[model samples]
Target chain A: MIRIFKIALRNLLRYKRRTMLTSLLITLGIVLVILFSGLAGSFKAMMIGQITDSSLSQMQIHKKGYVSSIDTMPLNLTLDTNKYQKIEELLSSNTEILAWTPRIKLNAMLSNFTDTTNIRLNAINPEKEILVCPDVGSRMTFDKGREPGTLLNPGEVIIPEKLAKGMNLNIGDPIVLVANNKDGSVNGLNFKVAGVIESILGPQGKEGYMHIKDAQELLRMDEPEVIEIAIRLHNFDRLDKVYAAVSSKLTGFINKKGVPEFEIHTWDELSPFANIAIMIDFMTITMKIIMIAIVLISILNVMMMSVYERIREIGTMSAIGTSPSKIMSLFLAEGLLLGLISAIVGNIIGLGGIFILNIYKISFAFGRQENLLLSPTVNITELLWVSGIVLLIAIFASLQPAYKASRMEPVDALGHV
Target chain B: MALVQIENVSKIYQTGDVEVAALSDINLSIEKSAFVSFVGPSGSGKTTMLNMIGCLDMPTKGKILVDGKQVDTFNRKERAAFRGNVIGFIFQSFNLFPVLTAYENIEYPLVLIKNEPAEKRKDMILDVLDSVGMIDQKNKFPDQLSGGQKQRIAIARALVTQPKLVMADEPTANLDKQSSINVIRLMREMKDKFGTTFIFSTHDPRIMEEAEITHTLVDGKLT
Candidate 1:
C-alpha cells in the first residue's frame, strides 16, 4: 500500500505545473471557507453577546399571556407578591442561575415642565438589574457631575438618549413621571435625571429606567408586583438545559384556574436580532457548499486528465498483473494526497489570516452599538471538519475517472499509439 | 509436459458491419524452458497468437491451457491473477513506468502481485537486475537510460516474478541492430538461468534465427 502511494505521489509530481495549479485552486477555496467561517462566526457571537449582556438577559420568565400583550403594558397581568416570592426561591436554589432580577414594565407620561411625552419605563433594583444585565450600566452616559458606572438611585431616573435630546433634559435635571395603577387610580413622582442610556435597537427606541421603590410609590402598589423576570446563566451555551430545568421545576406551580402561570423564553425567542444570527449561519452554509463544488470540479477535472494521459501506463500496469482495484486505488491515492496537502496549506494560511484580523482588531457597528471589535477565530474541531469534507469530496470526485481507468482492456489499451 | 498447449484456436474480430478473421484453426504446443519465436509479416496474427497464449485475449473457437490450467475459460479477474502469478509480459516499447526507477520497475511485480517480503524481494530484484547486466543503472529512470538499457530493465522486470513463461510481442521492434542482439541475448540468458520459457514474435529474420524453435505463420496459418 505504501509503495503504491509512493508511486501515486511521484505521478502527481510528474505533472508539476498542472498539479500546482489544481492544488492552488483547491487551497484558495479552503482558505476562503475558513476565513469566512472565522469572521462570520465571530461577528454572530459578538452581536449575540451584546444583545444578551445589555438588552435581553440569557432568558426571561413572565406571567402567561403577558408577552402577547406586552405592548399594552398591562399592569393587571403582573405576577403577584406570592408568585414572585416562589420564583425568587426557585431561582436562588438553581446552581445554573447566575443572577435574576424582577422589573415592573409600564408606559408612563414624562413631564419636563414644558414638554410632556409618553415613555416606556422599566422599574428595577439597580444592584440586581446590573447582575442580570452586566453590560446595561456600560450603556449609560453620565454627565460631568455624575459617576460613570453608578446606575439609578432611589430618586433618580436614567432617561433615553432621544428623549433627553428632544426634551432638552440634562443629568441632574428634575422630571415628573405620571402613571395609572391597576385600580384606575393615577399618581405621579418627581425625580432627578441620573444619566442618559443608549439604545441598542437604534434611535427609534424610547425607554427609560427608574428605581423600583419610586415606581411602586408612583403606582401606589402596596405589594411588589413584577411584570417580568430576567435570568442570567453561568454559561450561555447551557441556556437550553437551564431553561428546561427551570421550566420543569416551575411546572408544578398552578394558578387558581389550573393552568401554568408562567412562560419561559430564551434570549433568542425574545429578540429579533436572532434572525440576523440565523441569516449569518445560512450564509456560512452556502459558503461551504461553494467550497465543496470548487473541490469537486477541480479534482474531477484533474483526475480525468491524469487518467487520459496515462492510459498506456495503466495498460502496462494492468498487463503486468496489477489488479483493477489497485489501479483504482492508485488514482484515488493521488487525489487524497492532493487534498490532504492542500488542506493543510490552506488551514495554515487561513488561521494566519484570522490572526492578522485579530491583531488589527477590525471594528464595525450594528444599529446604535458602535466599535464592536471582530475577534476572528475558529476552533480545532471546525477546522478538522472543513478539511475532512474537502478530502471526502476529492475522493468522491475521482471515483468515475479511476473506475474508467481500472476497467480498460489491456489489449486495446496497449494497442494505442 | 508442455508449458503451453493451443488446440484448434481461432479468433474473429468484428469491425462495424464486417467480420474479420485474425486467426483460424491454429494448433501448437510449447515445451517447458524453450526459447520459441513466432515469425510473420504484418497482419499475419503473430500478436494475436501471443495474446491468446499470454491470456491477454480469448480464442473464439478453441481452448488454451498454460501449465495445465485452462486459461481461455478464466474470468477477467482470474486472468489477471493468472497473468500476475503464472506468466510475465514484455512489450516492444520497453513500457517501464516513467515515474519509477529501474529498480522500482523491477520490484513492481514482486510487491504489487507476488506480495513478496522485502528481504526476499530485494534479493530477487537485484539478482535479475544483475543477470540482465543493468544492475548499475537500477537507480536511473527509464528516460535517463538508452533504449538498450530500458529493454534490459524491462527484461529484469519480467524475470523478477519467476513465472513459468514470459511472452514478448515484438520485443526488438524499437531497438537498433546492436541493441536488438543484446536484448535477445539477455532474454536467452534469463531463460537459461531461471528455467523460464520465452515466447516472442518478430518480423526480423536475424532475431528469429536465434530462437531454438521458430514457427512461421503466413495468412493466420502456421507452416
Candidate 2:
C-alpha cells in the first residue's frame, strides 16, 4: 500500500501543472463554502443576539390572546398580576433563569405640545430591565442630560433617537401622553423627556421606553391589571432547558374552563422575521450543491485524463502482476490526496478571509439595523463538515475512471496507441 | 522437468460477431533454466502465446500450465497472484512507470508480489541493478534515461521477483542495434546467473540467435 501510495504521489507530482490547476479549483470552491459559512453564521449570531439581548430576553410568558392582538398594543389580554406572581414563583425555582422582569405594555399618543405621534410604550422595572437586557444601557447616551436608572423619579421617558428627532423634543422638555384605559375612559398624563437613547434593532426600536410605574398609573392597570413577564437565562444555549422548565410549571395548571392561563414563547416564535433562519439555511444548501458540482466535475475531468494518458503504464503494472484492486488504489489515492490538500489549503484561505474581514472592520445595516457589526465566526464543526464532504465527493468522482483503468485488459491497454 | 506446458491451446477474440483467431492449437513445453525464443511475424500469435504463458489471458480452448498449475482454473485474483509470483514480464515499449525512478520501478515488483521487507527488497533491487550495470542510474526517472537504460531497468523490474519464468515480448524491438545487443546479452547473462528460465518473442535475428531454442509461428500456427 505504501508503495502504491508513493507511486500515486509521484504520478500526481509528475503532472505538476495539471495537479496544481485541479487542486486550485477544489481549494477555491471550498474557500467559497467556508467564507459563506462564516459570514452566514455571524449573521445568525448577531441577529439573534440583537433580538434576545438588546430587546426581548430569551423567552417571554404572555397571556394567550396578547400576541394575536399585540400590534394594537391591547391591554385587555395582558396576564393578570396575581396569576403571573404564581408562575413567577415557579420560574424563580429554576436556577437556569438568571433574571426576569414584568412589563406593562401601553399604546398611547405622544405630543410635544406642537405635534402628536402614536407609540408602543413598554413600562419596565428600571433595575430588572437593565439586568435582563444590558445592551439597553450601552445604547443609552444623553442628548442633553444623564438618563435615569428607572422611572427617573416618575413622569420621565426614554425615547428613540428617531422619535426624539421627529417630535422636535429635547431633554427635560415636558411632553403630554394621551391614553385609553380598559375601563372605557380616556385620560392623559404630563411627563418630561428624561433621555434619548439609540434605537434597538428590529421592531423593538419602534417602542417608547418608560418605567413600569408610569405605565401602571397612565393606563389605570390598578383598575384592571395587564402584565407580561420577560426572562433571561444564565446561558442562552440552555434556552431549551429553561423554556421547558417554565413551560412545564405553567402548563396543566389551568382555570376552571380548562383554559391555560398563560402562553410561553421563545424569541424566535415571537419575532415575525424568524423566517430569516430558514432563508439562511436555504442559502447554505444552495452553496453546498454548487460546491459539489464544481468539485465533482473538476476531479472527474482530471482523473479521467490521467487515466487516458497513463494507459500503457497501467498495462505495464498489470502485466507485472499488480492486482486490479491495487491499480484502483493508485488512482483513488491521487484523487484523495488532491482533496485533502485542497480542503486544508482552502480552510486556511477561509480563515484568512475572516481575518481580512476583521482587519477591514465590516459593518452594515441588516433589516432595520443601522450599523450591525458582523464578527464572522469559524465554527470548526461546520468547516470540517464542508471539507470532509468535498473530499468524499472528490473520491466519488474519481471512482468510475479509476475502475475503468483498473479493469482494462492489459493486452488491449498495451496495444493502445 | 518442464516449468511451463501449453496443451492444445487456442485463443479466439470476438469483436461484434467477428471472431479473430490469434493463437491455434499450440502445444509446447519450456524446461527450467533455458533461454528460449518464439519468432513470428506481427499478428502471428507471438504476443498472444506469451500472454497465455504469463497467465494474463485464458485460452478460449485448451489449457495452459505454469509450474504445473492450470492457468484456466485460476480466478481473477488468483491469476493475478499467479502472474505476480510465477511469471515476470518485460515489454517492447520499455514500459517502465514514467514517474518512478529506475530503482523504484525495479523495487515495485517485490512490493506488489512478495511484499518484501525494505532491507531485503533493497538488496534484491541492487543485485539486479548491478547485473544490468544500472546501479549508478538508479535514481533517474524513465524520461531521463536512454532507451537502453530504460529497457535495462525494465529487465531489472521483471527479474526482481525471482519468478519461475520471465516472459519478454519484443524486448529489443525499440532499441538501437548496440542497445538491442546489450539488453539481449544482459537477459542471457541474468538467466545464467539467476538460473531463471527466460522465454522471449522477437522477430530480430540477433535476439533469435541468442536463444538456445527457437519456436517459429506463422498465421497463428507453430511452423
Candidate 3:
C-alpha cells in the first residue's frame, strides 16, 4: 500500500503543470465556499443581534395569554405586583440572567393638540430598559431637527420619528395620550414630549414610550402591573438552556385559575424577520451543492485523462502480478491526495481573505441601519466540513475511471499503444 | 510432471465479423528449470502461446495447466492471484514504471501483491538488485537510465518475487545489440541461479540460439 502511495505521488509529480492546474481549480472552489459561509454567517449573526438586543432581548416572559392577544395590549390582563416581584426575584437568582426589564403595553391614541394617531405604547423602567438595550436611547431622534434622544422621565413620552415629523412636534412639546380603564371609563394622561425615536425593529404604529408609573396611574391599578418581562442572558448560545431552567422553575406556580401563569419565547419566535435567517441558511446550502458539483466535474475530467494516459502502465502492472483492486486504489489515492492538498491551500487563502476583509473595515447598509460592519470568519469545524465534502466528491468522481482501469484485460491494455 | 502443459489449445480473435486464428491446436509441455523459446513470423502464434501460459489471455478452446492445475478454470481474481504467486512477466517494452525509481519498481510486486515483510522485502530487493548489477542505480528512474540499465532493473523486478516461472515476450526487442545480448546472458544466469523455468517469445535468432529448446511457429501452428 505504501509502495502504491509512493508511485501515485510520483506519477502526480510527473505532470507537474496538469497536477497544479487541477489543484488550483479545487482550491478555488473551496475558497468560494469558505468565503460564502463566512459572509453569510456574519450577516445572520448581525440580523439576529439587531432583532434581539435592539428590541426583544434574547427572549421574553409574558402572562400566559398576553402574546396571543398582545396587539390589543389588554390592560385588564397583567401580572399584579406580587407575581411580577416573584418572577423578578427568580430572574435575579439565576446567574445566567444578565438583566431583565418589565413593560406595561397599552393601546392608545396620541395627539399633539393638532392631530391624533393610533399607537402602541410601552411603559418601561428607564434604568433597567437601558441595561437590556444600551442603544435604545441612541436610536431615538429627540429633536424636531433629528438630534439624539434621552431616556424617558416622569410625565414624559417618546413618539416615533415618522409620527413626530408628520404631527409637526418639537422637543419638550406637550401631547395627550388616552385609553380606557378596566371599568370601561375613559382615562387620559398629560405628557411632555421628551424624545422622538426611530424604530429599529417591529412594525410601524408601535410608536409610543412612557414611564411605567404613568401607565399604572392612567390604567388605575393599585399594585404595579406589567404584561411583559424581557430578559437578557450572559451568552446567547445558552438561551435555550437558561430558558428551560427558568421555565421549569416557573412551572406549577399557577394563577387563580390553577393554570401555568407565564410562557417564555426566544427572540426568533417573536421576531418578524426570522425567515430571513432561514433564507440565509438555505442560500448557504445551495451554494455548497453548486461547489460540490464543480469539484466533481473537475476531478472526473482530470482522473479520466490520467487513466487513459496510463493504460499501458496499467497492463504492465497487471502482468507483473498487481491486482485489479490495487490498480483502483492507486488512482483513488491520487484523487484523495489532490483533494487534501487543495483543501489546505484553499483554507489558507480563505482565512487570509477574511483577515483582509476585516482590516479593510467594509461596511454596508442593512435594512434601516447604516454603517453595518462586515466581520467575515471561518471556524475550524466549518473549514473541515467543506474540505471533507470536497474530498468525498473527489473520491466519487474518480471511482468510475479507477474501476475501468482495474477491469481492463491485460492483453488488450498491453496491446494499446 | 511437466511444470506447464498445453493440451489442444486454439485461440481465435474477432475482427468485427471475421475471426482470426492467433493460435490453433497447440500441445506442448515444458519441464521445470528449462530455458525455452518460441520463435515465429510476426503474425504467428508465439506471443499468443506465451500469453496463455502467463494467464494474460485465455485460449478460445482447450485447457492449459500450470503445475498440474487447469489455468483456464481460474476466475479473474484467481488468475490475478495465480500470476502474483506463480509467475513473473518481462515485456519487450522494458515496461518499467517510469515514475518509480529502479529500487521502488523492483519492490512494487513484493509490497503491493505479496505483502512481504518490511525487513525481508528490503533484503530480497537488495539481493536481486546486486545480482542484476543495478544496486548502484537503485535510485534512478527509468527515464534516467540507459536501455541496458532499464532492462536490468526490469529483470530484477521480474525475479524479486522468486516466481516459479518467468515469461518474457520479446524482452530484448527495444534494446540495442549489446544491451540485447547482455539481457539474454543475465536471464541465462538468473535461470541457473534460481533453477526456475524460463520461456521467451521472440523473432530474434540471437535469442533463439541461446535457448536450450526452440519451437518455431508458422501461420499460427508449430512447424
Best by TM-score: 1
Task: Grade the docking of candidate 1.
Answer: high
DockQ of each: 0.87, 0.74, 0.79
Pairs that collide, model 1: none
Over the stretch A1-417, how does candidate 3's per-residue lDDT look in tens digits? Answer: 666677888888998999899899889888888888898898888878776766667778888877777777777778888888999889999999999999888877888788998777888898898877666676675654542334877898888777788899877899998887777777888999888777776532245788999998988887788888888888888988998899998885787888998888888777777788889889999988998987898889989999999999999888877889999999998888888888899999989888888789668897678999979888999998998999999899989999999999998899998
| lDDT tens per residue, model 2, B106-195 | 988888767899999989999889999999999998899999999999989988888879999999999999999999999999999999
Name the 10 consecutive residues with the lowest summed lDDT in model 3 chain B: B201-210
Error of 1 at B12 (Å): 1.5
Screening candidate 2 with a backbone cut-off below 3 angstroms (N, C-alpha, C), the clashing residue pairs are none
Give the Cα error of residue A336 in candidate 2, in Å: 0.9
Candidate 1 ranges with C-alpha deviation above 4 Å: A202-206
lDDT by residue (tens digit), candidate 3, B122-179: 9999999999998999999899999889989988998999998999999999998888
- Once model 3 is optimally superposed onto the true structure by TM-score, how far is the C-alpha of residue A311 displaced, in angstroms? 1.2
Recovered fraction of real interface contacts per model? 0.82, 0.73, 0.84
Best by lDDT: 1
lDDT of each: 0.90, 0.85, 0.86
Ranking by TM-score: 1, 2, 3
